[model samples]
Target: MSGLTVTLQFSGGAELLFDKVKKREVELPALEKFLPQINKTDWSLRELLVWIKDNLLRERPELFLQGDSVRPGILVLINDSDWELYGELDYKIHNGDTIMFISTLHGG
Candidate 1:
């Protein structure tokens, strides 16, 4: 990692927005170090989202999620574009690129 940034947002109103991130930038190595903190439970983003949907959003009874699903309810933007459109979770991110994990209902 050598100069990267990650923007995390959510659809559940303002409570989910990170007040501390503030369009900040960090080294790629620093960003990579945060990988463990971003819920990459099984070495992959999809796997992490599965855990998130089950564990975090378990109370949302009507919500159903899948590993490769990317749409209105879920949007993962990497480097300003949808990751799904560019090899999905396997998309390669370079230094200075920003990865934004957003749940729809925000600006999706």
Candidate 2:
């Protein structure tokens, strides 16, 4: 019950790779246990991506992750703002933050 709480949303084709779930509430470990490599006091979106791929992703992970980042054509928004404005993967994930993923590759 004591950890970083955040909301994850998947849209377009992104949800397809996540068991068709559109929204998820995740509780990440404290800063110390989240990702100690970068900063023991914070967790970055980069680490969150890896965590999601390893923990939440139910199938076809490659469709959502590529290398150290999200697959191409997937747009990410953090707290209602484009992640690019906050350094994308480098952005620090805060408690109560909302992260959304939309796959533009989905067919019309």
TM-score of each predicted structure versus truth: 0.41, 0.88
Off by over 4 Å in 2: 34-39
Which residue runs does candidate 1 get wrong by more than 4 Å? 1-22, 30-72, 105-108
Best by TM-score: 2
The residue pairs that clash in candidate 2, if any, are: none
Q: Candidate 2, residues 1-108: lDDT per residue as tens digits? A: 248899999998899888899999999876566565654567789888988987889998888889999999999999989999999998978889999999998564
Q: After superposition, how far is residue 23 of candidate 1 from its true place, in Å?
A: 3.3
Residue 97 lDDT (model 2): 98
lDDT of 1 at 82: 76
Leading candidate by lDDT: 2
